[model samples]
Target: MNKLTAVAVSVLLLSAAPAQAQSIPGWKAYRAQQTGQQAAPAANAGQAPAAPPQATDPQPAALPQPAYQTAAAPYATRPAPKPAPNGGLFVGVQGGSGWVYEDVDQRAVAVSAGYRWQAGDYSQVGIELGAGRLDETTWRDYGIPEVKFNTIGANARFNFGNSPWFGVARLGYWHARSRDGWDRKVTADGAYGSLGVGVDLGRHFNLQLMYTGYTYAVDSYYGDDEYDINRADTVTLGAEVRF
Candidate 1:
């Protein structure tokens, strides 16, 4: 009986020892789980890795343009003036000295208006009307009368070239009358011609330098005996305006 009880107790103790060991965690099993290799998911385990995305050509972007450009032209050219269907109207002013040929020197100022039609590749034909004053004319043709003069004229002009630098020619008829300050009245009728050059300031403005010569027949001055002919010349600087 004693031997059987001891055997039974031994078996119970041995079974309890296994249960306690299972309840306690082992350090070696913990370390193995931390350091061990992991398995891949079952779904992708057999497939080859996806090939890297195939490269495609990139699109081009617009190139930058230069800010400056080169000119192939050797010379500068003038721009054409505006012309109307009927004709173009223009106005001008001139101021300079006028001398009665073989007589006295005088200061002069003139204003003019004109109409022009294009006549050629680079020239314009025009009719002009103008009026002006001369400051003094000390001598009559016979050197007897002291006078200042007023002048009125109708003219024809030819402007050559569409360039900034250009040439001009004019022919005109003039009438001159002595001003009231003079002691006696005098009158002269004449024809005049001029040659000039001009620069274009811009589209509507121009500057000019001119030389003009006049020849007159004295209709009468105080009395007919004073003179039969009168002559004068002037150099003028002026401006022309067009619309």
Candidate 2:
């Protein structure tokens, strides 16, 4: 009986030692699992989801502008003009009547032609020819008669610049033929001169007032004549034109 009890106690102690060893191994395994779980979470938190692949091409930057550029130009301007000069050629006509005091008082018609050359700014020289008829007349109670005369002359003119007026001196020669109702013919040669002043109207027309003088010689059946000079003075008012 005593041997049997000692054996039973040894068996019981052996069984308890095995159980404690088994428990230690199980506790170590549980702790390792918990530590592994904590480490996993920390690693996950630290590693950012692999940074989304960084872009290769970056966005473009803005460019700058230039400060010194050229501007446009401005406009231009202009000028003025001048004037003309004066002086040229001229021509025209004249008509009027005159008288011879004491010797013969007559009415006549005359046609004349002439040319003038300018001698200065206000002066001219010219020559003229004219002819006319005379009415019934007698000289010195000699029963002489009526005659017609032909005249030729030259003249010089002077003009006043401030006015349209001029002064003239004329020298001329004349020839006359007479008819006395007798069976004879008579003729005379003479010289004459005139002094005058005239006013010009526009466009080559002028009005004139003049004093005329005549000296003559006669040839007839009356006899050989000496100093057959006849003297006459007259006034003429006429108009003239220019070409």
Candidate 3:
């Protein structure tokens, strides 16, 4: 029996020896390594994975601007006006009747030619030459005939505004050389003044009616040899044109 116990103890010792060798630092080091690996994974559990590499945004390039240009300025000026012509000349004719009252009644018919010079818009000056025949019947001088005379004058006129109407005044000298029934041929020289109104038909035509007064001095007569003066009146109508 003792021998059998010894064999069993030997076997036991051999197994205990193997366990002691592994119990040295080597066994502890292997256990710690395994525990650390398990704890590391557990501690990192809540941590997020590294974010995927971030993509960088690209910046936009600047655009080019348009260049500025200035505009030109405007200028002002007035246009010239047309010029006007100078003086105008005109010629015309006139005809009318007259009366000389004395102890007898004498009637006359007159015809005249005239020229006018325009001084301005409102004034004019002119001259005229005329002649006429007169019929006289006094004391029933049975076979009496007609008498005739020559006349000449100068006149001035003024227009009112630009209308067709005008006021006129004239002074003139006239001579009448009697050509009929008087015993001694008589000659008369006279001063005459007149007043009238006129119408301008256009730049080319015009008409006027006037009353004239004449004062005359006679050279020879049927009765008086001295200087004897008499008054006479007349009405005239005229037409004229510009050249």
Tens-digit per-residue lDDT, 45-102, candidate 2: 9676767777689768865544332333233333322111112233323344445447
* Best of the candidates, lDDT: 1
Which prediction has more favorable lDDT, 1 or 2?
1
Better of 1 and 3 by TM-score: 1
> Which residue runs does candidate 1 get wrong by more than 4 Å?
1-87, 101-103, 137-162, 179-182, 219-227
Give lDDT tens digits, candidate 1, residues 5-45.
99999999999997877666895576566555343445457
TM-score, structure 3 vs. true: 0.53
Q: Regarding lDDT, does 2 or 3 come out ahead? A: 3
**lDDT computed for candidate 1:** 0.70
lDDT of each: 0.70, 0.66, 0.69
Poorest stretch of ten by lDDT in candidate 3:
78-87
Candidate 2 whole-model C-alpha lDDT, 0 to 1: 0.66
- Root-mean-square deviation of every model: 8.7, 23.8, 21.1
Clash list (residue pairs), candidate 3: none
